[model samples]
Target: MTIQATNLGFPRIGARRELKKATEGYWSGRLEDGELKDIGRELRKRHWSLQAECGLDVIPSNDFSYYDQVLDMIAMLGAIPERFADIGDGKDLTTYFAMARGTDQAPAMEMTKWFDTNYHYIVPEFCHDQHFSLSSSKAIDEFLEARELGIHTRPVLIGPVSFLLLGKLRDEPCRPLDLLQRLLPVYRELLQRLVAAGADWVQIDEPFLAMDLDESARDAFQQAYDGLAGSGVRLLLATYFEGLRDNRHLACRLPVAGLHLDRIRGNDHLDELAAELHPDQTVSLGVVDGRNIWRSDLDATLELLEQARELLGQRPLQIAPSCSLLHVPVDLSLERHLDDELAAMLAFGRQKLEEISALARALNGQGDQARSTFEDSRRTLHARSSSDRIHNTAVAQRLAAVGPDDVVRDSSYPVRRKVQQAHLNLPGFPTTTIGSLPQTMEVRRTRAAWRRGDIDDATYRSFIERQIDHAIEFQERIGLDVLVHGEFERNDMVEYFGEKLEGFAFTDNGWVQSYGSRCVKPPIIFGDVRRPEAMTTQWLRYAQSCTRRPVKAMLTGPVTMLQWSFVRDDQPRSDTCQQIALALRDEVADLESAGARAIQVDEPALREGLPLRRADHDDYLDWATCSFRLATSVAGNSTQIHTHMCYSEFNDIMPAIAALDADVISIEASRSAMELLDAFVDFDYPNEIGPGIWDIHSPRVPSSEAMTRLLERAASVIDRDRLWVNPDCGLKTRDWPEVEQALTHLVAAARTMRESTSQRHSA
Candidate 1:
């Protein structure tokens, strides 16, 4: 049997986040023009060289992006929004970023989770008369760049159908897929250019084939590839993040040279795929998981492939990761601080590439070296399974002890609102910023110094306290009704809680891009999770002491803690989430005990964690909502519980969100102009709601009049008494100046609405 090793994509953020620094520097004008492009070129060159050195038979180019791949595809097809038409050339960084981050003249395109993953993508906006043309030479240029470096590479592009399916139709009466025919010609032109540039293979990623598709969507895929089939380059139709399932027959029958299957997520359908494959086509088996950090079980994987080898005697097969490695860290060996025991069970993008290479060699019957590598993998798997530290008896017992009563609050929303309102004594439109303020350069440098032991603990603590004091004074000066400690003592919300909790591991340079120039190092949950002590109580108490206003205690919610982390696969995710919920439940009780009146458990990932297929939604929502309730049920009725969600579509899961039962739930609504609040309005959502008035993701500050209009619209649907005012999310990603301007307007808008409401009542 002949087998090849390959990669779908690599992390463009770089080993030490070089791309992030360069991109942000360019945005701030700190780096001159073309400097960011230089960094991108360097990252792509380094990534290609690394994959080639790892013995990959096929390396993918054009997988790197200045911001996101979806936006890249949009640019390649000349689908720039009409608002950005007056900017620079269609392919320049200024126009591209203007579309993503928004110009003062227009709002940015909406963004949401990339399928079920935490990574966010800039949503494509298509008009009724949207036109397509070959607007960019990025794919061809990258392919030739790799060729010049002596590495023949396959250029990857999001498939024409999936690209359309992932986008939105703005001011149009037709579905995005209706424009498929217009989109295909540009794709064909790009493919022809690549063919002319000496490209032999192109990986067209159609991940939506794994999603539940209607008949029209299914037909769109066939129509898309059929049009591009005439192009003179070999097309490898790639599907990841799921198995083909019901679409297996259609996917396998597609007129393409090769098909890649995500065996890790959709292993059960492999037998059917083997039966359905065309004689001349190659089948790439995704044996290694690309979304996580766990070491693969080589013995079991090889055995499965051996069975598959027999299923198709001489048909060419390739071994690759299930999806792009962009979701994972760049390199594992760069982590010098991780202990031997934990590091043995982990694999980053570079390590996953090596694993893919080793598997290919072992499958091809190369030599003793391959066998030795398999043996090492087997040992690591054994160590991971048998490690006593993975199973915490006390944590397990506590989770088992959790009953239905533990997930219920003391009273319903009406009763809790009355007590909370009286105790807090706030205004009609309660104004507050989200949990975190900006993490400035000083904050980052101080944290780094503390971590490196260059500064003493006392010095760091004092610095944090002063920052908190500044934040408090700023909020009070702005006339905000509620307040936060600004989260100066913390880093990434999930990572901070992970550090305080047991059974979680950290990486020094495991950064994955969350959005444009924004990255997060998701903690590795390798073992049983339990909080060692009060995670946020000390900070909450100190901040409360410094302010007369009710200082809110911010905690990352249980569901988010699970969804954001690289969790353990050894247990059902629900069980692990329950353990985390219990841990946070303790933290919640401690915060309330410390006299924290308002506690915000931010679950920005709740909707992101929902199963992609509707059939699986019920089971996931049940556990997810139950987990959130379990965490916050410990708060007293007077301790107003708030939860936050951002960059997500909550309309479908409003019931599950209401089930979270937070007294006040805040969500991202500014970008949509209060369209998301229609879900709450339709559901007659009982809890108090805070429809965010500011789009925190952008640097452009909205005028108070604009925010007031949004508030008036929200009050039109939601009861005036139930409305609260806040930003779409935390201000951490924004700068201090924009944050100050934005919050200043947010407060003014709330006051304007209050006065307007009072005038109407008096009349």
Candidate 2:
């Protein structure tokens, strides 16, 4: 038996990002239902045809989504919440989008982090009395749609266990797994429909199995598969992100026909897994890297597959990616602006598909075809691996020269706090904002005009400076201690810097959706990463010159800059991150030299970069935290280094946050009602902290009393003097009126805190 090619998933954002444009247009009343459906059909056809072209033996259907897969699962199981059901059955496209992104009249279900990725999924809400049935048949419909195009495909679904695990109970304590006995019927019905539709194989993804699971959760997995085992379709139980360590015995005992393991991230499990595979079960080895832009080392991958083949002689082997291609960009070939040599060193979603196919062909003895592509890939890899452009000898020497003492300042936190307090003395309780103010429609229009040459550089710069001046003057009037220039000129914190750096390339339309109606166009780092000149010096200097109040020089930290962008595949990520850190190190020195007293390097994506498995988190955090220190450690004792993180649950990563050694950290805590402060209390963290006083996700301005109550909660765990009051995140998404109103109450709350503290001390 030979290895067959398969894909865990492919990019759903159409080649032209037609879905993004169509969804936005439909929401804005610019597109008809017919137009949107046509685009969807075309995207599915293109995706299927491309997979077929890559010679994939098991091409996946039901993976193309207008929004997200988790939402699709909610529709498939007919688990529509009561509020959403009023919009009518799932067939109505308008109602579907309304559920995904609420209308003017209806508030959408809360969207939250999707397993640490920037991509957000609509959280499924289940009431205590919830019942399940097959509500929508999207899986069957998409499978049929692909069959009509003459491509027989295996349908993909988020497994019952993972679906229930990822979802939340609406104001109830019942675990979703508690409903497994009832939910089994809906999944069975969906499977039977696919089986009737002539699907021979079905892929059910249960990624949560890679995480730490209790005995009950493990038992539920076995129980869920027992019902699905007899469904006629051959079941492929896919687990990615990391290997099944503690759960390996349970996985081996499952009744599923095959198991898919991510070898890229879980390479350590290869030998162990080979010895544990059931005699009758098939093995799908995910040797291709999915989350990164790196090119595969074909020789190494082939050898691993070959070893697996030897261990499980007659068992069928399937080659695939470690996870979905949703985390990566589409088509490296679309990058026309990148230099040819650098472009050859990278692989996007489409190229990854080809890698899977090539590996399969090589294993099947079509050695010549495989050899041709392998040699080409190797040539590109070797050339980039040793290229003079990528290696800055001076930078590498500086990294070697760095001592342990370099990461630490001259004095400890106690001494530095005293110096900082005296330098910026103002009030007992201080109020400031996380960098950006707002990116209004006018600012977007001006940037667009300048890009099209409709406006000159001088005109654009003058407009941005005016916005900054207004932001500064407004903050002063509202009695803010520290102020921001509002980041008016930046398209994105990282993209703007990436555009100015030497080793990066930008696309006109490389937009990837970060959350509901918010998209980020991540720049492609195509060569050795180095800042040829200062990326943010001019705007930062200009803003500092205008404000008498201490204006924090903002820079996206090294780890975050790498995490958010399409990084170069030539070097190890740790090495590439260090390159970015050194570049920022120079900029940090410049910011301090230019009379700036504080600098906030935002690493919002740091937690997102952690490996899915608990065992791997420590090593990942080590490099990630080290990169942050390398970026900010250049500052002198008086320069207060601040870092901002948004929408992150920091309880688990508290030690890593503290290790960054920033003078102050402002985190998104208002939504959690200062629940994150519990970690600080338990750990006795000594650094200054800011738990957000108000949630900025909504337009409603929080009352001063509300803000005061939140600050009081923070004060219980953190020292009052060490607390800084701020919003949950940046104000780019909000309007000026909302920003002004929110900060007004924020300032008032700090005033109340100071007065209460004075009375308490006097008493």
By lDDT, who's the top model here? 1
Best by TM-score: 1
lDDT string, candidate 1, 584-663, tens digits: 99999999999899999999999899877788899999999999999999888999999999998889999898899999
Name the weakest run of 10 consecutive residues (lDDT summed) in model 2. 102-111
On the 0 to 100 scale, the lDDT of residue 328 in model 2 is 76
- The CA lDDT of each predicted structure is 0.90, 0.83
Name model 1 segments beyond 4 Å from true: none
User: After superposition, which runs of candidate 2 have C-alpha atoms over 4 Å from their true positions?
Assistant: 32-37, 78-112, 125-131, 168-176, 268-275, 367-372, 445-459, 502-511, 524-528, 568-572, 671-674, 693-720, 741-763
TM-score of each: 0.98, 0.90
- Give per-residue CA lDDT, model 2, range 1-763, as digits (tens): 7779999888788656778888778766898988988888898999999989988998999888778788888877877777766786766776677677654455455556677577777667777777998988889999999999999998999999999888778667788888888899889899999999999889999998888898889889999999888888899999988878788888888898899998876754656766777777888988888877768888878888888888777888999999888777778777766667766777788889999999999999987877877987789778877787766677677767877766666678788888988887758778889998889889999998998899999999999999988988999999999888889888899998887776777765566667654677788776667777776777778888887789888999988888888876556788778778888988999888887788999998888888787777898899889889888888888888999987656788888999998999999887556768879767877798888887776545778998999999889888898888899889987888878888999999999999999999999
Candidate 2 clashing pairs?
none
